[model samples]
Target: MSHTLDTYRLLGRSGLRVSPLALGAATFGTEWGWGAEQDEARKLFDLYVERGGNFIDTAGTYTNGTSERLLGRFARDRRESLVLATKYTTLRRPGDPNSGGPHRKSLFASVEASLRQLNTDYLDLLYLHVWDFTTPVEEILRGMDDLVRQGKVLYVAISNAPAWQVSRMQAIADLRGWSPLVALEIEYNLIERAGERDLIPMAREMGLGVIPYSPLAGGVLTGKYSRADLTATPTGTDDGTRKRFNLGVGAVTARALEIAEVVKEVATELGRTPAQVGLAWTLRNPGVTAPIIGARTPAQLEDNLGALEVDFTARQLARLDEAGAIRLGFPHDMLASDRMRAETRGDLKIEARQ
Candidate 1:
């Protein structure tokens, strides 16, 4: 079945009803050199809300706090009706070690700053933006539980952390009666399926909803980039930051462009845009609670929203999967091997559990 902005789904094990797709506020400010200005950002917010979208994702450090500030203004009247989520853990000062980390001081400080910028009394959701690796898991979970007790945060989540670490943290939270993570956010797209190896499955098993960012692979899956375009310089109309970022992460590989070609082919076959096909592919995953959509213009936002209406046939879905498939590596491949499965099951036809 197809979904829409109003097709609310429970986020993870929580009762929080969020849209199937989330409107990312990272593009709400132009201080980053590639985001929308105030006027255009307002239009994006209005359009999404008018269409019944209720979940909004932002970070305290996004666009130097301008993203959250503008979102505060735009969502003021509808603040209660929307689920406002923001992240912490990014460095706020150049030399201060305490300025950023998953530690208690950084977490509390960041939440206070976000509340001020968002012009709100409390946040609906708070994510530990990234794992600092130095703080103990107990410290992070205890801090989050304190925030929830204080009514400053409704829910706590994590992003960009190792699967093992997140799993351990969740276990600790459960044991200590602290607030558990209800969501896991990561960079997931056709070109970046590394999350599938462990993070995706871990979230599903741990009852944490998977929220994928960069669902379009930094616009590569939109079929707008080509090998020839790789050498081109950024113009006023185009932002080179994403391309450079993609390059740095090795997301702009030759194989990625090849997968984008398949996306384009499927779009042509289904009479949909590549963006819609690319996003629909992600939405088809049952593990995915939502994929954050970012846009610098209303036209792009409209185009991305159309993804909710696109559905692929069995063949098209298989083709897209084949084009972007990655090796599971290590135990995954070993467990899925025919000999191992036969030994594990032993001819008894048992209903497999997810």
Candidate 2:
């Protein structure tokens, strides 16, 4: 099925423009076990490009580099046709000690390995993947700038880093004339509003493209396993199949069911599925540059890609907002207080209506 997405947007703070939805190759091969076969992986890549997807994300540690190698083989013929983004800083070996870190040596080595596996001379964008307090800001910045200079990476980005630290890196990079971050890969969704505290604002201010990894929140937001869902029982998390693995969220569990019920209603009204409703809700967020959809099969990818057709009216969005809404907390909560609003409006003679 063809998609309506045509023009691409510039990657966060960078000159690279990519499709609104990117294909995540974390499930490309079974380096970590439980992944698509190589032939199936190739088909998935072809289908994504067929649907106009132009951005791809992978990592060195994903399936112990199986994902990157598979993507490299699949894209070698069409490398210039897509915007490829991969990450470093995740450990694959247990006792290597220097296998993964934000340090210059690790970054350099990781890129070299990734390049060999990816069969590419340069990356469109490279992310640090996570923060490591062991490395100083200057060292990290200079190291990444060196990669850009060496033509190993076209742009530098950070993922899962604190707002202050991200800001400091930017400050250091700017002062020293090093490369700036162009994107932020974060765990963000409607049910998880924690990023709003600082990450969201910082990304908006710094012009970083926000690529939400799990827009479906490990199927939590998809409403697939709720009691009343009438869908397949959720895949077992016993063998560590669950992301956020085992946090034991009764509140989230209950809320997700409630949200599932609401989603069923909305989906019925719109003639769509509950999953479609959830994905569409995430798409309505203006701050998100794209949602990385992970699929183990062509059929699964089809289901997610179909979500682009699901649109929400103002009233529909308001309902889902109430269902999956998370408390902003702290200053955000204080600012939302009616008393504060009333006080601020008093100077304009906008007193309480009562």
Candidate 3:
């Protein structure tokens, strides 16, 4: 079924309602070297909020903090009606060792900075931006719970962390009566389905809504890059900055190009743009609560918002899945094997419990 921007969904086990497509503020400022300036960013913001979009996502350190500053200004009037989500843990200063991490100090300091930058006394949602693998889970959970108790943060979430670690943290929160993580953000798209093996499933079982970032695979699924562009040198312009970033992160490889071909084919079949097709594919996942749309321009934002109207036929979805499938390694593959299934069921017509 097709949804609108106002078709709100419950975020994980929480009662908070959020739009299916979140408005990402990562591209809200030109400080990143490739993003919309203040006026353009405001236009993007207005376009989204006018369309009944209420989930606005950003980070305290995004675009060197310009993103949050701009959002704070634009959202000043309607902040109460919007679910403003920002993250912590990315370094706020270059040389400060305590400026980042999931520890208590970093958590409190980052929340304070974010509240100030966002021009708000309380944050609707706060996420641990990255997992440093050094801080104890207890420290992170306790700190987040403390913020919730203090009313500095309403909800806590995580991003870019291992699946096992997230699950463990959730279990700890339940045991300790802390504020549970309501969302999980990860780089997920047709070209990057590694999250499917564990992260997606983990979120489903642990009650964390999976919010995918880079749902377009850094524009690789937009059908803009050709095989010839793979070898072209990246320049310093805004467009070149994206290409350079994509190349540096290995986003525009031969395999990714193959996946883009399938996406374009599906988009053609559906009379939609490749960007819409790609974003729609992410929305189809039952485990996914929302996919962050990082469009830098009003036109791009409008195109991305069309993803809500896209519905894929079974055949089209299967083709897209085949083009970018990943190996679910180890126990997942082993358990799904026919022989293992037969051994477990003994040829009985077993109906799996939903």
Candidate 4:
């Protein structure tokens, strides 16, 4: 069945009802050499909320905090009605040792700053932005729990973390009676299916809702980029948005363009935009609670929202899946081998319930 913004889904094992698609505020500011300015950002926010979207995601360090500030102003009247989520742990100051990290001091400091920028007394959800290998998992969990106890945060989550560590941390939180991570955010898209190897499965097994970011593969899946765009060097006078994004972490590749071609073909067959087809593929996953949609303009946001209405036939889904499928690697492939499955199941005619 097709879904809509008002077709609220429970986030993970939690009772938090979030929209099927989340509005990402990373494009709320122009400080990144991209993104919408305040006026345009407000229009995007208004359009999403008008369509019944309530889950909005941002970070404390996004566009140097401009994203949060703009979101704060835009969401003030509807603050209580929105499921506002933001992350911490990214450095606010370049050289400060305690300004960032998943430790206690950094968590408190970042939350305080986020609260100020958001103009909210408490955050509906606070995510440990990224895993800093330095801190103990217990330290981060206990700190997040403390914030919940103090009423500064409602729920705790983790983003861009390894599956093994996150699994361990969730276990520790369960045993210690601390607030557990209710969500897992990661860069998930057709081009970047590496998270499917572990992170996606772990979130389902561990009761953390999978919130996917960059579901459009930095707009590559929108079919705007071509083979020439991949190899061309920038002249430095252009917009620099796509160039800088392509060079950033999890940059686009030749294989990604191949996947985009499939997305484009499917969109053509279905009479939908490539962005809608690409985003719809992510939504098809039962484990994915939401795919954060980032847009620099209201028109782009409208196009992305149409993804909720896009549906795929079995053949189309299979084609898209095969085109973007990643090798499970190591143990996963080994365990899924026909011989291993036969051995594990004693060659019985039993179907495994996934």
Candidate 5:
């Protein structure tokens, strides 16, 4: 049997609605150790599409562009029906100066190259992969707007940028009436809630869709690493990701398992898995539009997709929220206080928590 989501969700706060969950085909080549081969990648893609996932996300840096190439072939026949999104500005080449960064020239060339690789005339969504500190805000916005005018890009978005930078970029776009970032992508998971600081509020106010990548906290949420101290070297195996990603278990790895215990108990109560709880946590955040699901196999994709079946009660949510919550700092923390709420609502009646 296959798992299916209940309904589609709008991207960001935009009118464009897509599958509540999306497929991330970054593991489509031999670049990464555990990456699924083209044939297996195709199967995973098919599984996702069959389960009603219409949105797909990828980037140029993935497997030296083979990921996009494979996706291009698999998506060809159904290009018009799928919400295809890709990113640029990671690395131009081995040592090319203009090869990477969010510079206008780099962004422009990346889009054109991506268009050729994907075999699509226009991308449903295009992301400025990661922020390059040197690139000017206006240059990025104008270059992207030019693509929209040229019919090469439908929607412009961003990934791995700070809240202040996004805010400034949007203000510039507003002044120029250019195509702005409609979405923001970050590495968010039960082990990583840093985006709640400025990113979430910025997204909420700007009407931007928040699509977090690495929602599994680099596989800690899977509960496999819990059996090991993980203080040793990351295991080396064709199916192993840690060694290849060059990361050992993090300091938060223990915390991830502690949360996993609650997740397992909850899953036992609901007959689900910890992986489902991790995914649901990301999906349930208020400003979250979608969490990109990366899978190296059809079975993994199917399992992650089952996250849609996991639900949390108010009490359950409170438990996980407090467990993983990060400090928002300064004004944000001040604004969330009961004292502030009372003052902000002076003479108005409001409901209190139980």
Candidate 6:
């Protein structure tokens, strides 16, 4: 069951092929106060590409744009061989009203900025970074289609959008013959299984591949944190380390620590790092196409890559699932109830399609 970086998989319904784990470039610059510098970033990029990884994920505002710049420099020679994916919709100029959002103006402007920063004529994949909820779906879809027709972007995808909105957009694209969203990037990890209620299921039916971010639960599932971290206080500052940021964002909660402990036990049983076990759990999901791995150092990156080789026993999988299980909520729970199933299908046993 072990696979290497070159063990490429098709991205959703598209003909495009990418690595099982995308190299996240958000850690490519130190402008964020907690990432790798130029030389170190180059080493990370080289290490991934040398191992046959082609999917590189970034955003326009990551590290105040330094992330994309470094990726641009490091990927210059192998640009054609790599799939450079960048996102938009984050406000670049704080005071500018038209600098951000999911509207046409912001879409076009952001694509242009991403293209310039990536140092490529055309982006292999472009994602709408965040949903503003104010813009109409038609406007967003049309603008993305226009970019595709203009040869500025090869594929269009989305991240951090509601399930209903994404499915509606997919329907609109299908009806109007626009560029359909091929991938969905969301925060999914052992600690964050909320996506399981709808997002993951919707993507499976809609033909969009699920690309999970924060598979380590912001490093909580990596077992580097202890219950003591739950009591840690944050130092409010513009420039902060990831640990401080995690504390501020409530990512170091007692419940999260408990899950990490279970992950640690499972990792011990499997003779692997908790980081690898956490990542492998995400990879095991049938709906996930790839999980984005962000590492500030080459050593971290190497340890994360070991996830592809870590397999689990049924008991181990069950333990991990029980540790981080979430309720499907509302209609899902109602629809899956025994009474509903009995009413819908009595004693007849029917095989469901896979």
Local distance difference test, each candidate: 0.91, 0.79, 0.92, 0.91, 0.81, 0.91
Estimate the lDDT of model 6: 0.91
TM-score for each model: 0.96, 0.88, 0.97, 0.97, 0.92, 0.97
List ranges where model 1 is wrong by over 4 Å.
Answer: 231-250
For each candidate, how many residue pairs have backbone atoms clashing (under 3 Å)?
0, 1, 0, 0, 2, 0
lDDT of 6 by residue, 134-207 (tens): 99989999999999999999999999999999999999999999999999999999999999999999998998
Q: Evaluate model 2: give its lDDT.
A: 0.79
Instruction: Give candidate 2's error at residue 354 in angstroms.
Output: 34
> Which residue pairs overlap in candidate 6's backbone?
none
For residues 1-354, write the lDDT of model 5, one tens digit per residue: 113543677776567877777788788887866688889989998888887789899987788889888999999988998999999999859799788889888888898888888888899999998887888788889999999899999998999989999988987887889987788988888878888888987887886888989887766676655546546555566554543362443533566768767766666777777778888888877668889897877787878988887778898888878877778888988997989988898779768632
**Residue lDDT tens for model 1, 273-321:** 9999999988888879999997878999999999999988899999999
Off by over 4 Å in 4: 238-240, 247-250, 348-354
Write down the lDDT that model 1 would get.
0.91
Better of 2 and 3 by TM-score: 3
Assess candidate 1 and give its TM-score to the true structure: 0.96
Q: What residue pairs clash in candidate 3, if any at all?
A: none
Across 1-354, the per-residue lDDT of candidate 2 in tens digits comes to 123444577787777888777888987876554568799889899999888888999998887888999999989888987788999888757788788888888899999999999999999889999897778888888999999999899999999999889988887787888999988889876566677788878887887888888666666665556454333343454332343231333323666567767887998999887666776676657777777877778887777787788878899999988877777788888987888877776547645432
* 1 against 4, candidate with superior TM-score: 4
- On the 0 to 100 scale, the lDDT of residue 261 in model 3 is 95
Q: How well is each residue in 256-292 modelled by candidate 4, as lDDT tens digits?
A: 8899999999999999999999999998777689999
Residue 213 C-alpha lDDT in model 2: 81
**Where does candidate 6 stray beyond 4 Å?**
236-241
List the lowest-lDDT window of 10 residues for candidate 4. 234-243
Candidate 2 positional error at 193, Å? 2.3
